[model samples]
Target: MGKGGGQVHMGNKAFSSHSPSPPRNNSGGRGLGGGGMDRWTGVIHVPLSGGGPTFRVAASLIFSPAKTLAVPRANAILFTGDRVRGSGEPAIERLSDAAYLAGLLARKLAGEANAWVVDAACFSRSLAVYRELVPSVDAVGDPRRYDPTGFPASAGVANILAHCVHEIQSTITGTTMKDSAGIQDPNASMLSSCPPRTIILGFSKGGVVVNQLVTELACLESEPTPALSTHNLLVPVSASDVLSSISEFHYVDVGLNCAGAYISDHAVIKGIINYVLHTSKNLRFILHGTPRQWSDPNRPWIGMEKDKMLNLLQDGAQKCEGRLVLSEKRYFDGKPGSLLMHFEILQVMDIS
Candidate 1:
């Protein structure tokens, strides 16, 4: 979505380096900017490897076809499962998973109206990087390790991803909000106005990244951000800007290593609750997971069945007037013989 006339800053040198140069050929394919996947427009590529030995994190942006630009109601930032390699059909299929979920949420918010659509972007990282980021987890079992001291190294990577989301949200919000201000004729503007909400959905290990991003966001929202001071800010913004921008956060079958959610920090959790109650009127966090037996219970991954998790989310809901909801729905309960576990949840998740 075009950002009206405002400037949408991607980031400083770090993100700028990964940006692909504009495509030389410009055809009358779609939108104000002619195109097939406008490298210069909706999408951005952030190279997490940074010319280092470990080429772990990679981010790609995807938006609805220009036709949907008439009514971009909701903006979604989706995180796919980890180690999604190659840009071939396989990778597209993997990314399509996030896109499908994002579309589901968009349609839900849009209601029966078929005019509105959702724009989604996905962030993916390699498992090789996990060993360095989360040293406590056992590589043998994979996605099942607990780092007693908490993941300090992950803060840097998480900050980068959070900053990316912030920039993308800012751009989409500004553009759609402005577009709704009446760029098109009366007949063209959709029945519903541009969405004031942003939805973030994460699945599998990608959910772990979302967890760290939320923790980093909570710390940023604190009065004095000492935690953020330690990490190098790829994109820096005021806390009010970040807090005000986010409308909803969804963790779909988030990875188990996320023991250090908001519950891990009392002050951070308190700050977020007060902020949400006072400023974020419609803000909410949705936690959805599958049955514990379907997930790897042997590993110390944080599951919905885990007592600590219930206590943590329940505490937040209690503090914030039930703004948080935890749900566990069997994904494959049509008298299926096998369990639908972690990955299947994304496939069967019904946003409504």
Candidate 2:
């Protein structure tokens, strides 16, 4: 989606003037698609400024004013796997690890501006899920009551993330849309930075939880009313608000169930695609891990499930036309008998 030279117009009058695009070197080994680089014509290499990982770049079409970004640089919500958040314990250990990720994300988003308000505390510790069915064991508290084991409860997990986004987007006056100061004036450029974008990261079993939550969101998006009556959420939230607030969704080392735990639910899958298509302007997906890990056949139906889920994502990407950027990277040591590297994918932002 690279915009070419064009005139900018508002109403009946065109913008002041049009400037020529930057000159292309056109010489071999330099300009886009020059000689052997035809495929990379519009691509540019951007080194990761904070020294974490290099990001694959595509052409950027939107530009924002150079004003300083105010408080609450971005909102992030992280979901960890089972056993990480001890049953009745305060989830301290997991929170400590999450803080590391929060710092990385804060740095990445802040870029060279050095403005980031996100922290480990911004990420919720964990969202438990169905233990027996999902292949995880609840290590603490009352396993029967705290364990999440079914689709409804899975949906509730998603609702929890949505509620967090809503809360972050909410102002002290209790409104999710921060337009009270005329900041969201319709006349403003549609390309200006969006209301603080929601960043979601899930690791291990949390990846499965995140996927299921996405499935549930897809199901609820089409409903006349997406009920927030689930026991998981501390407060009720509007389904539309939650969906609209999301700008990025990521699943790192999501485990074997990463493929399609809910691919059979076509309505839900379609809802996810539609959400990406219409709801977010620059929404993207970041996926990492070895294919073997993601497609691990721990159960009889898993092989087929993975195929369907991946196929769905492929189809959705094609349908999105260039609006959605999907980035998928693999992290393997290249050594025989190595661990799945599921945990390491989070350190590098893959999949977009």
Candidate 3:
């Protein structure tokens, strides 16, 4: 119940002050610096339209009281999903569904306001489908070329998340404006001219993506970087600079299959928890799952079975230093099964 609210800003001076050592080789591919095959790359295909959106069932809806909270003008909402939904096929459909959900949140935050939505999934099939569904939204990196689905191993997830932060920063700082026209504008044009109060929303595997992005941003802010050639193009931006710009990070987990032996791997959970603890204090983590036997009582696994996942999340929230909100468990009793719960995660976001 740590409801205390405080402001954490990433200053430019801080960015100019320190430097981090080069990334060490990942040996077992588990540690932040280790090199283990990223588990996120494993793909599982799920039919989209048939399952119903998962967010509606798995997510805890927050009705903002007083119409608005005194929150940062510029916010970033990052969403990540479980592994089964991270594959090329399902990733595409899930993103498309999530876009709609994001749109809904945008409207709630700023009525009829169009916010810049970035589909950062790393499956070519998913990216293609996302583009077809919401062509106007700006997407960072090619899903096919960029493997976002593989992560929590060898910093693969962290790297993709960094890229996402960079992409958002570019749009906010007017860097993307120089790229070309037809870039979907969050406010008026596809390419956002002004830095917007941003929010990142991810589901399933997307949750891992958001976590790494936040961690990198925080780490970057702590260590400043030197000015490099912005002229080379393709050159990675200084990590410190990117981290300094982020104001807030929000992570939402929907219908997570955290109970599975393969899914509950220690490395994956530890990476996520470590990133959350070390990142900025201006963070909020929300988890939605079931309360069934699927959840491992001995571990911090969150799954959808009976409200067990939600209960575990509540427990985690208690130990967390930042604001933690747990949603009331809502079961998806459809004959088709809980698959709809997976799809609904995207459906609730109102992208279109």
Measured over all alpha carbons after superposition, the RMSD of each candidate to the real structure, in angstroms, is 10.8, 16.5, 18.5
* Model with the higher TM-score, candidate 2 or 3: 2
lDDT of each: 0.39, 0.37, 0.31
- Model 2, position 160, has a per-residue lDDT of 37
lDDT of 2 by residue, 86-184 (tens): 333333342324333433333344321111111111122443343322333233211122222234434332333332222222311234443212222
Candidate 2 ranges with C-alpha deviation above 4 Å: 1-73, 84-96, 110-193, 225-239, 256-264, 277-282, 295-307, 337-340
Where is model 1 poorest over a 10-residue stretch in terms of lDDT?
112-121
Q: Which run of 10 residues does model 2 get worst, by summed lDDT?
A: 7-16
Clash statistics: count for each candidate: 3, 6, 72
- Native-referenced Cα lDDT, model 1: 0.39
TM agreement with the true structure for every prediction? 0.51, 0.49, 0.38
Candidate 3 has an lDDT of 0.31
Q: Which wins on lDDT, candidate 1 or candidate 2?
A: 1
Candidate 1 deviant stretches above 4 angstroms: 1-44, 47-71, 84-195, 224-240, 257-267, 292-295, 304-306, 322-330, 333-341
Q: List the residue pairs that clash in candidate 1.
A: 137-145, 256-301, 256-302
